[model samples]
Target: MKVTRLSSKGQIIIPKALRAAHNWEAGQEFTAVDVGDGILLKPKKPFPEKTLAQVAGCLKYRGQPKSLDEIEDAIRQGVMEQWHDRVDTRE
Candidate 1:
């Protein structure tokens, strides 16, 4: 078992051997959880950053895309339907 000491500045230096064994790099983040008996240090998993191109073809749509005017008109029609429904219910 390896031993480590916490500095006065609240910083703990993980032993070189343990760091090498775990393949942990400097500046790596960890989440500390209080386990009642002791603390648990878990390596933070990072989420991959994706661009629009990476997620572009995720949706399968064989139909041609609608024009901007058609899209706006559809939205307006939907909103008017919702507003009419609310007004009708109130009356």
Candidate 2:
């Protein structure tokens, strides 16, 4: 196991070998969790924040899109079918 000394500024230098192995660079962020005996350091996500535009076309639809009235009618039909099924099952 590698040993490291915590500086007076409360900063600990991760060993060069370990840092190279983990590919951790300068300004890398970490989240520290307190365990019973020691602390666990987890690397923070490196990805930038995503916007709606980035995910806008995630789902692809080749066919024509349904209108609002068509969508509502489908929902009503489904509900009526479910209600009729339940009533028939009861009788």
* Best candidate, lDDT: 2
Worst 10 residues of 2 by lDDT: 41-50
lDDT of 2 by residue, 1-91 (tens): 9999999999999999988999999999998999989999989887866899998889898999989999999999999999999999999
User: What are the per-residue Cα lDDT tens digits for candidate 1 across 43-62?
Assistant: 88796658999999898988
Q: What is the TM-score (0 to 1) of candidate 1?
A: 0.51
lDDT of 1: 0.92
Task: Provide the TM-score for each candidate, comma-separated.
Answer: 0.51, 0.52
By TM-score, the best candidate is 2
Q: lDDT (CA) for every model shown?
A: 0.92, 0.93
- Assess the local accuracy of residue 67 in candidate 2 as a C-alpha lDDT between 0 and 100: 98
Alpha-carbon runs more than 4 Å astray in model 1? 48-91
